[model samples]
Target: MAQKAPWKTNRRKLDITPLLVTNHCPDNIWPGISTQSGTGPGQNGFQLKPGETKNQTVSEDWQGRVWGRTNCSFNHDGTASASGQGKACLSGDCNGALNCRVGGDVPVSLAEFTLDAGDGHTYYDISLVDGYNVPMAIVLQPLENITLDDIPPNLTNPSCQGTDGLLAPQGYNPYPEYPDFLRTNTSYPLPFDQDVDENKISRWCPWDLQQTPPEKPGDGVYPYPDDNIQRPQFNPCYSACAKNNQPQDCCTGKYNSPSACKPSEYSKNVKSVCPDAYSFAFDDQTSTFIIPSGAGFEVVFCPGARSTTILSTSRAEMLQLSQQGKVDKQATIGLKRASASKLRRNAASTTFRLDRTLLTVTVVLTVVASVHVFC
Candidate 1:
């Protein structure tokens, strides 16, 4: 029997199928401040502008929305599948529930392709749904030569380099001319315009007023008893008594007693100032690609929050071997002869005619076989 041709010996084509699954949740949603009468300036009561003080009167509320997409493809077979989902918060804390909300009917798609040897390629595609009942649009575009390795990990670093080092520590309080007592040591400067002369005069006071006096004149209508009288009334001429006063009450005899300024201390509650913003880190370990061999493949886990259409083309391929009956050793010889004949016929076809050497050999052998049969 003639040797079996390599091309007809059940040769297989290289196959590659990529499965892409993606899930996304709202990182931050710009819920334009609630337009309710009492809501603050920005969306949901959060202010967008800097230096704007938030008064207790204004309230804020936020509602979040999510969207997402997935794609799968088989390059060798030219087949593809795509799906998408989207959702919005029904109620509750926007941030906490944005990820938990279930997605609505997602659109799905499939496509197949075939080629005519080398003349041209044929392709068929179908759109599963128009918008999949989702608010956002989902689009899928065909991609060429895209592989699983081509996808890159989500970048976590900020794009721009910081120039904070170049900035000088807020130069000595912009109002250095004002005494230290007049300026608050904070990013926010007191709104009051400081009058240096006025502050200097205000700093000096009759300390004795802060002390308890021996007695108070008796008055039947007085709110308190004379024995409860605080230090003697401010006396401008009693310089000797003022100078000899205790350290706590420096009775200068010049100005009225200084009342303790409302005690100002740092707030322990971090959430008080930035109620909406938070310090957190996120870990995105999602696989950009998947392999599907037996079980069905799903490209998207979190349907809401991501685009319905993937930014790039994706594919999934599956291969199934058939098991009809056990092979017989004697059938091998007949199979070889049948395969060689098929190869010879194939070589003569227009598709394989471009290989001049192969075509010439096939033709010569065919002619020799015919002549030998006749003899």
Candidate 2:
């Protein structure tokens, strides 16, 4: 028997929707991807500030995850150094640099993905097996085939059957024209179960991971236990049986099989909140789900429980807005034409404000650059 040739496999390049992220937290949290597979190995990892939106692209062959890093600050050395923003982080630190060259430090909540690989179905999941640092969620970018009808917590309504989800209102809407967003919302674990606001499941600091340190210590010294596991300092919510590494606890040795790896107290705690999420390593039955190719994905940190949209319910409001947009465009065009006409009409006599002149020049340059790039 002859082995299959390389080219025989469908080496199609599919564009997974660019990741668009919005940080709802007041404090800035860095978000990054540790892209491990595909031709773009070196081309992964970036940072985002609070309330900032970033658009990114990933290849179909890409295998990696998106995670949020908190309480990190950079220095002149380009390493994570002590600054007013603090150093490294409480969780999800990638070496010392902002761009993660490798996977981030563990105990992180993750939106993991393996695109166009293995069985070739786009696999995605929200993993609590590493333990949760921040409240996170991921939902499919609605394709044309699906409509945003499911009201959340009822996964079968729109039939996101095999996929992971908690049906809530669309948290983030990228396209105004495509307002009917169908997404999968995973149930948050533990303290993240409740809604902080109508829009979100839980606040970023659901419960302080570490006890507050009374130390008004010296420079570069942050408060609390950090990574130290001393008495009273260790996070009470830390993964109990799993972290302990016992066979019955972590589900190893004899308990390695799925049926044997029963949920321990800690695993049950996670399971209670996010019943569908991967609570442990062998919780693969409910953890993994597949999306079709060309479907977009967003791994949002601090995902709100609900989403709000600006699109009006009435046809009247939508019509008014539409007309207004057209009018605005026409007005802008007329103004540009008039300005150009004036410039040509009386080159010597006409006077234009410095600001207006600069604006005109800027618009012309923008148009030229756009043409250059697109054309």
Candidate 3:
């Protein structure tokens, strides 16, 4: 044998997928982007006007977060103000820059992604764990060969059932633990509650966690004293971690483990409203979603009663629900009340059985003692 040639192996290239962000809100919104892993696309931030849609691309192994910045006004040179008001975004401001070099400020509704995370799957979720600023949804775009059955159950679509008249689309599977308080508590403001005063009161966010406007007026960017502009008081809701910074709320220090750090009242309420989104740290079971990589996605702002064809449910039932409009308020309340009463009855029955068992044991002991005395 004169000579032997070395064998060569072929390496596969990573795929690039499209990410389309649509603004369905009435006003302008700036979509802020940040990369957490691998090589990012470098397109950090831009503005999307009402009804406008922007498209970006990401690598197969990319990991990042996207959020919307509301009521933003930047200088001609793309520099925002440092005053924390006006000339900057009311929520999700990236520290005086139109193009974010870092993650936006908290209380922003987050749509997070990690492509090719594990086992050739991509992971994503809508997170209100940091709190919520606007309604958002992450929908996997339909591909040529992929069908609803091919998609993973949790990875289909995660939409925030947020304020600003947003509702969970028909046939969308909500979190399993969706509480009845969301239906029966008259005090908990429903999305379609006509009596809600958006300007004066918070629609659904807790009063203590509501974000307040800047104390001083700005140079027309925010337009503080403009009576013509209708302002919403509860536009952004703050998380307990961001507002209080306690170890328990932030899941830090001794409360870092899942067992140690349980959901707070704030997290529970938020979870009830937006079950598809993460309500607190370590809320992985119900919030995180995973699917095989290689599909495009759409991030929709202010999604209304859109078709739930891509959801993991019957299309016909969804259509029927869409036609029926809002849920039956009276029926929902009655069902919740009945459920509570049944739980109470079960508890009482258990107590009664325990007492009867104890009485029988006492009588048996007394009879045994009398038999011994007679002998």
Candidate 4:
């Protein structure tokens, strides 16, 4: 053998597929609410205006969550205020930045996931153990050439039956405000507006939280009169950890283990509103789903929200509901679209892009208004 040449084979490049994250919220219904995710392009925060849809891309192994932040403010310096009232969010405050540089503060309705998270499956769940800020749903939008039959029965459809509202085109309107006593969501049978202990008054709980800077070195609350804006409320929605220093509720100490820790009263309260989501430390059987790779997703803010398509009932049905509720239908009254959009310190600089295709129409079909039944 004169010469034997050594052979070298080329190594194949690994294919890293991009995951498209398409998100949207109820059109024009929730203007103030902002949606966000972590360990991805969402570090700088993302907003989907009412009836708006925005798409972003992430990697296969990305570990993160999708949730909503309310009552947030940021300075032009990109630094949010302290105590989660100023620059940070009063609820779901993430690392105290307009841009979430780290995981968010607790008591959030988390859409937790580790994309393509080993075992050839995506581990995901909507957890309420930290507590809930807004109702969210992560929908796996079907794709071509993908066998979705393996998708667990629980993961096939949307999650969370969010608050219901109007059917536009024919007419979009709100029902009259009930009396304060009646308006109180604490009233049972259907305390839909109340979150658990009735502290979370709908999505816009307490309406306004105390930007009243943390009480120096004290645990009690402080009120402001000299400064009109910093007024504080007696009962505000606080996370489990904030409510109690108990290690179990905080998920600290030995209670960190699933078997060691148990669901608290707060978790049960949130579970009442969002049944499908993770209500506690070990709610895997009901809250989470494991799926094979390569699936597109749609995180709808108010999942199962009633809209025009589902509301197009016969006039007779509307009339009957109206008669039953004693609602006035003949007269057309006007109510300004409520804006939960808080007046942040950096109000001018914060911006969001709206998808025109989504903004243009409410739904495929048109229906007359029977505002009572829908709104």
Best by lDDT: 3
Query: Per-candidate TM vs. native?
Result: 0.13, 0.55, 0.63, 0.52
Tens-digit per-residue lDDT, 134-245, candidate 1: 1111111112223211111111000000010111111112122222211121221221111212122211122332222233353434445333333222111111123244
Candidate 1: lDDT of 198? 19
Evaluated at residue 252, the lDDT of candidate 1 is: 29
Compared with the true structure, all predictions reach lDDT values of 0.19, 0.44, 0.57, 0.40
Rank list by TM-score: 3, 2, 4, 1
* Residue-by-residue lDDT tens digits, candidate 2, 1-375: 011111113322443445555454334668767776764333344555544656676665677787777766667555664563544665677776776776766666677777655442455677767665555556555333222121121121111111112223222211121222223221201111222222222212123322232233324565453422122211213454424557776777888887787876556555544544666777765555443334456665544332211111112322322222111345434434543443243334434322211111111221212111101
- Cα deviation at 306, candidate 2, in Å, is 7.1
Query: Which candidate leads in TM-score?
Result: 3
The TM-score of candidate 2 is 0.55
Which wins on TM-score, candidate 1 or candidate 2?
A: 2
* Model 2 ranges with Cα > 4 A deviation: 1-17, 39-45, 83-87, 142-237, 306-375
Superior candidate under lDDT, 1 versus 2: 2
Which RMSD does model 2 reach against the true structure? 17.9
lDDT per residue (tens digit) for residues 246-359 in model 3: 999999999999999998877886665666578899887666655445556778876542212122222322222223311234644543454345434433443221221111
